[model samples]
Target chain A: MTAPSQSPIYDRVALIGLGLIASSMGHAMKKWGLARSVAGHARTAETRAAALELGFCDEVFETAAEAAKGADLVVLAVPVGNMGALAEEIAPVLKPGATVTDVGSVKQAVIEAVAPHIPNGVNFIPGHPLAGTEHSGPRSGFATLFANRWVLLIPGEAAPDAVAKLRAYWEAMGAFVEEMDAAHHDLVLAVTSHTPHLIAYTMVGVADHLRRVTESEVIKYSAAGFRDFTRIAASDPTMWRDVFLTNREATLDILGRFTEELFMLQRAIRMGDGDMLHDYFTRTRAIRRGIIEAGQDTAAPDFGRSVTGAGE
Target chain B: MTAPSQSPIYDRVALIGLGLIASSMGHAMKKWGLARSVAGHARTAETRAAALELGFCDEVFETAAEAAKGADLVVLAVPVGNMGALAEEIAPVLKPGATVTDVGSVKQAVIEAVAPHIPNGVNFIPGHPLAGTEHSGPRSGFATLFANRWVLLIPGEAAPDAVAKLRAYWEAMGAFVEEMDAAHHDLVLAVTSHTPHLIAYTMVGVADHLRRVTESEVIKYSAAGFRDFTRIAASDPTMWRDVFLTNREATLDILGRFTEELFMLQRAIRMGDGDMLHDYFTRTRAIRRGIIEAGQDTAAPDFGRSVTGAGE
Candidate 1:
């Protein structure tokens, strides 16, 4: 399995919606020779043209149905809200015995929307890659986007062989693959991704609403801390909107907990409880150390922002 | 004023609390010949030894009073809560014409705490350099830490010549200097720094409290979004604790607004209001663009984290 000459995992793979994740998958698959042919589709002619020009895929189609034709694997990589319609469009053209999966952030919603459209003998495995940049479009992707990142698979009742093949494919692409149930995957992601994004978005909004501080001042002085929130909030708005809508319960639950914790900290600040604030801050520091130890992020200061000269 | 051979801004400089900011000041002063001699003192012997060994100061003193002796400029780089005590310690030994300033995050508290200790002829200017990293201590200091970052000066009743000299010193060190009243500086920082750090700390705490997700799992999947929070939360706990405690009213006020905005977003999510989320996310994206345009941060994806091999 580790040999360079290993056969391609799929004879043909189709990526529907040539955005960041899809384009990144195309690059990773091509770099590792994980698929014999990679095909892509997007709603706009410009995106399809850009994908072909960027060599993200061997062929580009204007419609999802056309892209799925003759492919052994089909990846739905659009926003979560569009997953159901795209699944329905490609259901008729999906090849027998083909395996279909998605790279949506919310697993339960994707499973609920796309599972019903899977044809008999076709595998429907829902997956979410726990990685992304605060960028979008075909040009934003690179082969290393998935390197050392987690790609969670929610196979439900998919055949064992099909699940194994998909796991091997993700492994080849440099992602660590694990199987998880849909609901658990959604909840975990809420705590890790969705709620954080929402908080970042809300903070940026709050900063903008403060009339006393000019926007120029906010931008000029952002290096202190607010710049990180801007980076997270800059992520593709459409993708995040769909994530919140589809993962409503889990995201809300996590957000509720976050507000409660924030309120406690606020009370401590109001009461001038320095000891409590110090203890809370110290405890949070350990979590950051754990992330660094796990190799998920670097120990480099400022997320290595200074190296780019943009930080200066 | 821009000539390279201009006389040193101060004949002798004393830095109280030889941590990241003071050590960086020492390095910057040496790099640009901004000061004739640099002396430092820290509460911990280990820190003072490290500062001397790292060549961060020309001399290390046993006490704040000893360090301030014969110094033309004395900078209080200690935690906000320690400013008053250190000021009292160094007041008797301060040179008659010395200019005393601080690099505390909260300006009003520093002014209030240290103002009474200033000698008859000494200038007291409370300043806050809006620059830092998650890492702390003498080892984390670097000359370029303040490059292109803001250093806000709350001069209050300080002489104009004194403020100009300090501004020139910081400009030589590559920081842009801006003057603001102490109260306004505290409020602005609360919006841009203190509250953001608090929110990040709270988010990380919430993730840690989630019993359903193991800490290992949270760490493993942190790249999704939570990793940024971890970085912000990892900032020096003592410094942050002091910031919240010292700037209680402004920090709590900002936190109140943040909670209100967060609640609105949370309600939208709970109600499955995708339109509200999409609009809010869109508005936040504009603020990010503003930050990038102002050169406060980079447009590079992931804060340029991907440039380092750790991102892969």
Candidate 2:
């Protein structure tokens, strides 16, 4: 924490739909003094009140239009389902030449939904900060939430300066920013985020049903591998729902591939072909190594800890 | 570190394989003073030397038959693939009244593979100590590895005394004992362990391939939900292979169900069905809470840290 120095990422930034991502941005902005002032809006009055109470913004507005009035940067932090509606609502009130972005999980659908509603003078950069936790709402944010996380911005090769500014804003917010095509972004996230989440939800559902039948306190014995699924399954419901609803095709495509492979492994298991399972498991370990080497994740030692220890 | 006591769990305990579970059991047995002596065998002489050098056992032998000689309790700690062979190898030298058990991930397979191979006078009770870390080898275990972890025993109604003795042995090794039929044990573990590990392997494979095609450091951005898969994927390959092969039917059954639910969620995402995704995500959170409450797992407050901040 240094003495706050003025940053030029944005002036009078307006956040529409103050949830996890938006509140996080506010925290980052306040921590770095990136924005001249921060104003936010939410559909529910309680959310707006909570945002202000949590000191996530300079002021809270009742409407997206009010929040966007004269702000140089307008961030739509609503769910994918509400992106188009919020874009339409703020179109009239957006300040001239203001750079508008979002933090939605789904990319292409958001582009199609939000692009049509942006005013011609305003820069529309469909964006997603690939940083969040299971917690949601305005109060569940902290300064380091976006630290070392990705913030993917899809500009469709339309505005490099606008994209650069947005990227810089994310960088200042402690996020690693990448410029990806909206369709590719959707496809990548489908495998990385969407399908994994759905699979987790399904597994937990199965476990729940098992609890009913076995009466064995199966959940009590969930330490081995099931706990990981439970954590993913515990993500923000509304945000995930919107992501799946908006990014259906990509998710289904990857999920189909996953099931095909899973079926092959299942067949091998059933046939007692230990070779297949062994080969697959061995190959998977290489990927884990690659991920760690590529700096995509922590080594096994620092996995759950911020500090390092031996592998065992 | 306490004075020696007369009532050791066994006069001499022979471990047929010195892998992660076995090594950990040795540590636990020493901590509890539950064994007069701990000795083990490895397939390779080099591994036996390494285990002995690492002080994992009082004596390390190169052959199962040699290890079982004069030992009152013989524990098969080999992979399910090697269980039958090891049982046959050790049967000739096993003491007349020795109790034989195992720490295989799959119970039914071990029972079918090893029970008939045991000598006529030796009592066999198939067991699984549901505790481990991703690391393997003799040096990667600790005395507390089985603490608070479940140890499933399948006695086949053979002898109450044998079951009681085995349960007491595991209890002395710091595990809570649970008894069930062999097939039921396989089914429960298929849901709780095997299927989860398979899914993790599949996902890591998907992410790795995706990374190669993208030519970007995908795993660096993996903190979102990918690291869990990596940890699970990094599990001992041969052991997991044996588990999948042995627990094939149940694993496939669960995989089919998981695939069905995954497809449903994928469809909902494609259809822009936010309601469906929200409902599924919310439901899964409850399962996570159930696990935490049951003390089967810790809450994901700090990315799966134990509540007490204690070592596993």
Candidate 3:
């Protein structure tokens, strides 16, 4: 690690395929003065201008190669499907000995996509930051978004030194970083994140189709339970679509198990079994306590208000 | 309404059936001096003792008729299934010109069950209070539980004076009083509260059975959408069973519509139609916004904390 006086992690930090994660990284780096200069590149020119106009990145480039030139760290922050192409675009232009990493939710796809293009002199690391808002794109970027959030680092079993340095970089950016195998990461996330999203999507879909009742009534009475699903279902359609498409195997596996369990619960409800409902509801309480103790959430997320004074 | 300093609504109030709602009403009455004394009677002495020990009611009695002796107002707070039996027990002892009300979730059943055995000079006013916690028994009672919540009164046109009096009593207890037809109230509540609870119960039941991947993961990663269902499902199972049994026709009507709508979304997912998924997800966002505007929920509830808070 650098001395406190020389604390900079990167001289020119390049952010490739900017979206909610990438743009937020740029904002965070600038906020903490962790990088000398923050430059970003996206496939869409409109998005490039948005990155610049939003003032999230110091420099915006249309091509990944241009953005990567001379930068010491390049973060791939795109949909998993676009990671390979972005890797190919930046590989030849990245500085020798520079560290390349990513912030995709799924680490396996990210590692497989970006590792092949890493040249002899460069190090490629895969990371998945567990922090995010349902909103996407540059406008949703915030400096403190990743503070206290988990970022899983999967660099295989080969590059200890590079992985250590990337872990320090994430730490500097106000994130808690851990190292795990890409496959295990996928499975754990499938249980925690993907399955939850799928269930939410399904519930929202169910509520959306209920006929006889006017839409106004559903909208009015969502506080009963359906509102929570709406928030999760409102997540970026394109990003979630890519998630289900790319992580199909794990998601489907979990869903199949979930359906079977649901059928059992249905049978109990039909049979007028209150004890069964009581026991399951009671057991789930412990896990929610674990999540809170894990600091995965606050007393409540005060959205649209930026009310962090309670914690501060 | 009695100019703020008039006599209590009931000189001697007898609260039949001690449960969460009854206990809460007892607490609110005690806290603000809304009623002189909350004399309660439960079928079993155990619940009556529990209520007295919890300090939820001022006094406890073993028999409904003994509790109703000389009482100017009687509130039935039992399960809908037992309302008729309790009414029969209390009918002979109630004072002349007494005003009787209930806090059942379903309106029509409460009225039908209690209205029959009413004494010649008594007035029966059916009520439905839309406020409760998942926790049951007297200890769960809190004065503020009904604060800002809706309390619906169904006087069926003829009992306007009694309805108006009950509205004042609820308002004094910090509730917003709404007048709805008994049938219309049941239908709206089935869509708003009943159907949502059933669906949540069903989904959590599903999650519990899917233990291979979803059992633990469902609770841990509940934020994706499933957590909402789990929280709703975690509500008191006995109360819900009573709700379903009492509001059968409306609950079934909404359930049939809900299943049909759910099938449509299932077909879209099976066909991999991104546009349909996006459209439904997007439309649901507006409904959530509307719910928020209706002052139903704070910006966002504590996702993981909600499941735990249900107990608190």
Candidate 4:
């Protein structure tokens, strides 16, 4: 029988990490009553306490297995490098018919690491939410973080009903859900997220190591273009490190292409090839227009950044 | 003589090339009464008409010379490549004791191109405003574009009074003004603006050229990191081309360093060096905090991007 419209989708949901994505999920689930009870586990006592204090979770556990016990759905929200160990830890306690999904940026590695440990009756779906801010941690999340975002699900070997249920849950959290294969999801994310974050980190590192440009000058004059790169680079270090480490092949492939293209532009600059530079830049500009038209980004000047406190 | 608080800084100010910077300056001047009469010139008649219709300028001229004649201050706001030609066109019409400035990105090149064309009694101070958006054109200007933004003035060979007067004018327009030499300005900008922009353009171009990732997917899932690069890459193509061409030496130097560092990061990723990646990412994260502390950028998550219309 179908439940009432206002009824919770799951009797109880377990979140294995109390980072940005998991905390935001907890908030969204609580705001919409998507789950009757939300339980959480974090690596450190401090994070567990923070999650409980934040009130996104009804209860917190010291161990992920304890959190997974009696849960209708278990969400793996840890860094990619820790996914396999966490999955092994929580496997014994996973309830039969419970669906397990992850919120990792990389998909294939997550599938490989988490799938083998899942029980036969339980569903193991790897999912990624294409949404985040530079900030992280339990306190950095809000209910609206995934409101307009896309959540990609990889339902390998999962029952049709299980897949549908997971999709419905994400939809309830204000995200548009799509089905994607793990390998393809990893490649798409490499181009869209992993490679771009690497470039941003590299650029920021370059700025920091510059002896001629003082640290203050780099910070003060960052409004031009460097500030945007810094924002991307400012993302949680451990999480990003795991992303790069686990998604090595795809990230390196994209990075190689990036360097090839960058060298071409560098040559154009050295050769004073204005037409080449102009044409390349014009092509890139068109892509930006496409993004704006797709409503993936705001067309407001400077991402609608307020000018307040800039003068003070 | 000190003018009253409400009085204009200049009797008549001429703005050459009615684009983003010029139109923004016009709006700021009008809003703050920084100038008694604002005159503007654009290469295209449509832009000239738009400037007049936008009401940022009191009058619009078809020729730079006509706009410069009898003006107390003249601003060369054209692209870097056009600065020399524009300066020559307006040189004969510059009034005695008047100060001429530019809003070019590359200072040394602008000085080299425009300095020789300056009339003996007229002051030519090369300046650059560290403010802009992904958009350009006469209509893209706003009164607060320069608010709290830094405007670096290279007041080489200009009289102290002329430099002070121009500083006061910029202050009235809501900008914090600083002075730097032409070579140092070009180098600093290359590190802070030029190199970062080139990298962004290259990243966007790579995304555009990818065969595996569909354009729709790249645009739709851009919220992760690529969207920021698109914003920086969407900046005016012609202006950016001129910047790379004119600031070739410094841009090349910084580009070399950037690639070197990028290769290091790439190698680390290839070797699965998580600690190295984490440390580098953490270091860059600190720089972003510094920028927010310096009031150069907002601390808002994702630049406080609104989630409205994101789902619809």
Candidate 5:
């Protein structure tokens, strides 16, 4: 059931990382009064200070255990690679019956890494908010980052009331919440997110290594198509490294499919098969329309970035 | 030397195709008084009618020859594959001192296809405006489409005066103009535009064909990274097909580099080499910053599409 407008969903919430997702959540929770007090912890003192100065947290702690000591909800918002270690450190201080969730991209690896360290009395649910900007860091977040976006939760053996409460908290923050299996979520994200990101990083890398085409030339003419690839490749490096390492199998599987299709198109190009190229290009156009119709993307041409600015 | 502000750069300008580039030029020329009369021709009557109704042209003709008759500047804005035929059709009617240019993506191929049909005294200059949205058609144009964008010109045998006049006209439309060689232009675009499009098309195709991940799931969760690919892949099939077919050598060269780099990353993933992935991703980030610093893109996170709308 929906809570009354502006009421607190949790008496105290602990954010174990002060990055884009966690900072955005802090802003949204504070702006909407979804939590009575927000406590944050960052590995770096600089990030903790910045988060407090940004006013997204009521208090900042030097260690994860200090942040989770008395909180009702604990969000492990660090990189996938650090999930297990962070979970271990916070395990001893997690209040009994408290809910622990995550905002990692790959669900299965995060579940495996963090689930073990979570205390038995603590309800552990892995989650991922299907939203982000290429920019990262504590200050790179805003209150509306989750508005109209999807937040998927994997409630593994967690009590219904805990899952429901977490879902209600996210809904209060203006996100559409959904429940999904960890394995399926990993596979789906590999197809939609991981593989695409890997491809973009590879393309940008290729451009960078091309000596004949000067870097200045690439930068000057990037508005053509490679500009979009650069934006995707510019995302947080640590986050992506962890993503590829943790979600290795699914990402490699989808990448294999991608390479196969790319070779087919490459063959068509080499053979001068205009018809096949035309047909393939035409078929892909329909999926773009589907995304717009599905409300996952804007129908505005170039995402309406023209004239005003460049596209994403 | 710059002409008087708002003065006509050419008495008559003929556009061979009423697509995005041609229609945008028509609108910009009229708005800025760069051309006294804008004449247009399209293969389809529906497009011709739409162009005329949109008030981007003073007259609409049934054929390219009729449209080019007595014009001082004729722009061949059709697909690369159709350039030779259109040039042949308009060759006889070209004025002795007229300048014939094109807006094709690939310069060398467009030059090869159309140069033979140019009259002895007519000047042929191949130009490409590095600006456009995924939207196509005669109606999907605006007066400011080329604002602050780059328009590359390859002045093969065009007289100094003729090239200068065209450059002045493009500058008046708010584009920064640069001169380049045909072969180099094709190669650079293969890296910046052609190869990227092929990769995006391939990625979207892979997503579409995956049985485990439904099409709706791909579309629903696209905001993670795949959304940008869809926009690039959604571009006009005919135009892109001609681009790949005509620029085969360069596209293949770049694709070769791309595949090599992709394989390297794939290996790193298999071996869980987080350092390699992190190093590669970090290097790519500099290119995006270079593009933004060069004014080719916006620094706004997610193209500032958060909350207000979806990124490109």
Candidate 6:
């Protein structure tokens, strides 16, 4: 069911990490009145102070347990590696019948790590918003971050009513919600996100290590194609490290397939096989058109001019 | 030295392929009076008609040789694969004392292919404007395309005066001009553009072939990282195919190094080497910052939002 036009989804919502996703959620909640009061907690005092200054929350807590004490909704918006430990720390203080969800990239590992510690009577759901900028920290978020973007919910054994309420809250906060199985979600994301991100990181790393091409030259001429990889590689390092660790199997599998495909293309290039390269390049072009038609991305060339003010 | 404020650098200029680069040059030349008259030619009648309709040229010719006739400067703006044939066709008509240059992606191959056919007294200078949008065709160009971008000139044996005049013309159109050797230019481009494009094409191809993850699912959830690859993969098939074929040695060499680096990352992932992954990702982020500081790209987190209207 859709959320009501002007009602708060929860009396108190606790954001356990004051990063991009958490802060965006707070802003969205405030903009849509999805929660009556927002509470935030981060390990760093500076982040907690910054969260309070940003005015996305009514109260800021120094500890995850303190944030979860009286909240009806607690969002574990931390890196995947920290989820288990945080779950254990907050387990004793979680309000009875409250819904606890997460915004971790990897699901199965998070569920296994956080599920046992999510005390009885609390609903534990794993979620991931398929939206982000190549930015992190409290200041890097906006209310519209999740607008028209997917927010997948892995309900596990959580109650239907809790799941429905959570879905309504996300929809009110501008996300299009979908129900998904945890394993399948991991595999799909590995193909769409994890493997691609690793590849971007690798390519950028390669450019960095090339001694012959001066770093200045690489950066100056990046608009040709490598700049896009740089953009993706610029994402938060901690979050990505945890992603590869937790989503190990799926990421490795997709990467294996990718290396195989790359070898084929490499062989074609070495042999000067114009027809094969042309055919492969031509095929990929159609997929790009499909993405445009599907409204996932724009048809604009995005030569990094508008983004960087380069051609001005 | 810069050309005088109101004087045209050339009495007549011919662009022998009215595609993105040629059309953009026409616009820039017209904007600044860089040339007194511009004539264009394209293989397709439709492109020639469209070029004439766009009014970027004083006249449009049906053949490359006709376009070259009597022009003081002629630009072979055709694909790398066609440079030899186009050069042969236009050689007989090329004016004496004319400077003939090209905007090919692979410089050495183009120099080898187009150099032999140049008539005596005609200057054959191979050049590449390190700027473009993913969009192709004569209609996809704008006057500001070359602004603040690098235009590398490889003057094999062209006269110094002719090279200086051509450099001034490019500067007049707002490009930072540099002189470089052809083989080196090709190697630099392989690292910066060609290999990155091939990797993008390969990644997109991998996603397309995944049966479990429907094409629509990949398109829907592309923002995680795959969308960037899609944008690069969307580049013109014919142009990219020619680039890989013509820049075979350098492309293969870089691709070899890329695979080796990728294998190391892959091994680190499989071994759950968080330290290694973190270190590598951290280094790449610095290069991205360098690119921003160098005025090559922006630190704007270009979430593909403003360009695509996706998040809006």
C-alpha displacement of B131 in model 2, angstroms? Answer: 2.0
Estimate the Cα RMSD of every predicted model relative to the unseen true structure.
Answer: 4.1, 4.3, 5.2, 4.8, 3.7, 4.3
In model 3, the clashing pairs are A261-B206, A261-B209, A261-B210, A262-B206
Which pairs of residues collide in candidate 5? none
Candidate 6 lDDT by residue in tens digits, B1-312: 223347899999999998888999998888888899999999899998888888889999888899999999999998899999999999999889999999989998998898999989999988999777667899987786776677899987889999999998888877778898998888888888888898989999999888988776787677677777888898888889899899999989888888999899889989999999898888888877777666635532222222421100
Query: Of the pair 1 and 4, which is ahead by TM-score?
Result: 4
Assess candidate 6 and give its lDDT.
Answer: 0.84
Off by over 4 Å in 6: A1-5, A296-312, B1-5, B296-312
Q: Candidate 3, residues A43-110: lDDT per residue as tens digits?
A: 88889999888877889887889999998888888877788888887788878888888877677777
Q: CA lDDT of B151 in candidate 4? A: 86
| Residue A264 alpha-carbon offset, candidate 1, angstroms | 0.8
Q: Report the C-alpha lDDT of model 5 over B1-312, residue by residue, as the tens digit.
A: 122345799999999998888999999988889999999999899999998899999999999999999999999999999999999999999999999999999998999899999999999999998878778889987877777677899997789999999999888887779999999999999999999999999999999888988886776677677887888898889999999999999999999999999999999999989999999988888777777666635432122222111101
Q: In model 3 chain A, where is the ten-residue run with the lowest total lDDT?
A: A303-312
Please, what are the lDDT tens digits per residue for candidate 4 over residues B1-312?
Answer: 112248888999999998888998999888888899999999899999999889999998889999999999999998999999988888898999999999999988888888999989999888888878777899988887776678899988899999999999887776778898999888889888888889889989999888888997887777667777788888888998899899999999998998889888988988888899899989989988887766635432222222211100
lDDT of 3 by residue, B71-171 (tens): 87789888776888889988988887778888887888878888889978788888877666656776677877666556777776436676777788888
lDDT of prediction 1: 0.83
Q: Candidate 4: give the clashing pairs.
A: none
| CA lDDT scores, all candidates in order | 0.83, 0.75, 0.68, 0.83, 0.85, 0.84
Could you say which candidate leads in TM-score? 5
Over the true interface, candidate 6 deviates by an RMSD, in Å, of 5.7
Could you tell me every candidate's TM-score relative to the true structure? 0.92, 0.89, 0.82, 0.93, 0.93, 0.92
Interface RMSD of each: 5.4, 5.1, 5.7, 6.4, 4.4, 5.7
Residue-level lDDT tens digits of model 2 in B1-312: 122234787989998888777887787777778888988888888778877777768998777788899998988888788889888887888888788888888888788888888777788988887777767887777777776677888888467887898888877765678888888888888787778888888877777666423634345446556666677788788888878777777888888778777777767766766677677778877767665555534421222344211111
Error of 5 at A311 (Å): 15
Q: Which ten residues in a row have the lowest lDDT in candidate 6 chain A?
A: A303-312
A289: Cα error in model 2, Å: 2.1
